[model samples]
Target: MANRGRLFWKILLGFWLIFLLTTQLLWAVFTLYNPRHEAPEDNIARRIGNVQIGTAGAVLARGGLQALEELKASWPPDERKFFSDSPVVDAPPQGEGALPSMQQTRGAVSRLVMAPDGQRYLLRYDLDGLRNEYHQGRRSSILHMPPPLFWLGLTGGLLFSLLLAWNLTRPMLQLRRAFERVSRGDLSVRLFPVMRRRHDEITDVAKDFDSMAERLQVLVSDREALLHDVSHELRSPLARLQLAIGLAHQNPKNVYASLDRIEHEAGRLDRMIGELLALSRAEHQGALGEDYFDLLGLVEAVVNDARYEAQVPGVDIQLTAHQPEDYTVKGNAEMMRRGVENIVRNALRFSAHGQSVFVSLSRVDSLLEITVADQGPGVEESKLSSIFDPFVRVNGPLNGKGYGLGLAITRKVVLAHGGQVEAFNGPGGGLAIRLRLPHWE
Candidate 1:
């Protein structure tokens, strides 16, 4: 149909025409390979000679030698255009003297047969009639193709080409429809069900489309949830600021207390705003200045700062290295430091007093693996997987710490650097977070 795309028709008609031409070409080749029919003149001549022989033999069988002689004379000499003008040479029969004498002569375009009854008889035929008869027979042979096979081949080819074209374009059509739906904000549209298990480049493309759609759905959903949480978070600070301003207006003489509260709320708002910006940057911003930096030294610096901070609870921060070599990595040193510091500080916040928060760095192949484990109460196993999500937290002493952006930022920064982060409950009754980064060789 005309509604089919150009590619569809191109494939359909192209294959259909090609197959038809190929069938005709093969037939011609085979026809040529076999011997051709006898020439028209030879066929006509042989047929005429046989008819004359049969007529003469029948005359002899029914009416004896006299009948054949009269019949031979009856065919007029003028009708024998294939006859030669040469006179016949008299000769005796070669064998069987009891039989009548026989004579035969070969001419350039005609043949003469003397009757066996000792008579010089010649059977003749019109050359034009012979030619017309031969042409008629030849036409019959030429038109004698089997109808069933002819129709079957043509019909089968049409069906085969149609099926092939349909198979080739069906996936593309499905993909086009899926893309149309997705562009209209239907992120749930998927191409996998339409693919139907065919394993080809087209199927591969469908799989990739499905993956893209699924990722888009997750991204849209997450962005919506993050927006809701942000609105809720901003309302609290704005309300506190408004209330502080109203209190200051109520008691002008005692405005210092309200001023301090306003300043505290303002500072809170500033930190939250700064953290929000960092989270956004982690998700969408490029690398924080590419440089090769020593990861072990960064860990030690973060540990020293955390140790000073941890002194209030007497929590210990321990660092261990499995290898003595420098763990050089390529990324923004500041981003990696912040990510590692967040994990360690979060661990320290929940760690029981006098308990150690262990930090270990090791190399496996081309990867630098950093694991931070604390002796604090770990999160629920079900919530462990989603702890890195924005604004997600479990019931713990550190639940309200830092608006829950620390781990999320850590995940984003690590992912941007082509690394991975995972969290799980440690065997020794605390939480453990691991970071795997590609080491610069």
Candidate 2:
């Protein structure tokens, strides 16, 4: 779980950094390309070059350097042009490499001077430096930007990306801790609701995690109850067996009765274990064995099988349906049958002898409704909710003289088929168990 958050942040930061760096570099490149807008083969620069050539000619005339060169006096044409009329000042370095008039315009000429080699120079008289004055009017060159601006942008983008990563990962970290605790046997922990988004994917994930954790806690609690009930159930049979052994060694006449009690208790234990096993199988298989069955026929079969052991002397169970033999529903056959039998058995046990028990099979809308009603005393209103809990015997000893796992197992079976079971006092008198199942072909 921790790994999930880490992976999310890594991918988030990786993509964001990639996009940030690439976009920043692209912007720099476009800016660099925008300023190289020099016109090709310009005429202004050519006129500037001719002006320098003419200036070079005047410099040659002032000293008659051409005549000295023609006489072969071992003097350079530029050396003869040195003026003796006034003491010469030192020139800026590389006056010989100055630009021609074609490269220097009217505004550029003021900063330029012609040398004897037909070259123009941008001579800054006040500055007396070799560097050109780049800050002239209407022809400003690109200025170098300060280096800190790029650093500022990079730092800001990184901070924003990290903030986004945190927002995406914080709730995941909290959820991981909750899941870890639950996995390690702490079923009470809950994930902190750090993500408050109503419709986003993260919010959906959070809600699902909360729901799963809640369900897990309920299951864990139910398992604890099952373990407790099983242990208590085992003790009774073991105690009976111990008493029977003690009696057999002492009193032969009472041995049979003691042994019979032991056998009966052992049988109860076997049946309880079997019911629990069946419930477990039903839960594990889920809907694997689901198929359509006639609801009325299924109920009738369950009624006959459950009452095979004994029947109440004065109760009449009638099956009434709007339509006969066609109220089919989708469910596991054995589990559904047992579930119906449990409800019928419960009604038979609770209702008074010689009283009527009504078994109704019908469909309401899209549901198959099977109700077991009896004319017996009912339980407290609050006990209705917990009546289906395992080992919950509201009527003391039932007809089978066994623990009350039937209703619990019955509830489990009903739930596996996407159905619901409910208990309430009948409208007239006594209690009713209603089973509602989804109907399908």
| Candidate of highest lDDT | 1
lDDT of 2 by residue, 53-145 (tens): 345434433334453234325545442332111212464443453443323333332233444544333322111111122223323332332
Clashing pairs in 1: none
Superposed by TM-score, candidate 2 places the C-alpha of residue 119 at a distance from the truth, in angstroms, of 12
TM-score, one value per model: 0.74, 0.73
For model 1, what is the alpha-carbon lDDT of residue 251? 88
- Badly placed stretches (over 4 Å) of model 2 are 1-9, 32-101, 104-149, 197-199, 285-288, 304-312, 324-326, 398-400
> Backbone clash tally for model 1?
0
Q: Which ten residues in a row have the lowest lDDT in candidate 1?
A: 99-108
- Candidate 2, which ten residues in sequence have the lowest lDDT sum? 123-132
Q: Write the per-residue lDDT of candidate 1 for residues 1-441, one digit (tens) a residue.
A: 667788899888888887766765666566567685545575656666556655655465456567755775787764343432222467544343232322333222333344445443333434445565445544444224334445555777788789999999878788888989999999988777767588778888888998999999998998999999988988887898889889888889658988888898888788888888888887764645678999999999999999999999899999999767769998788888988999999988887878999999999899999999998889899999988987776764253546777899899889977899999988878999999999888
lDDT, residue 110, candidate 2: 27
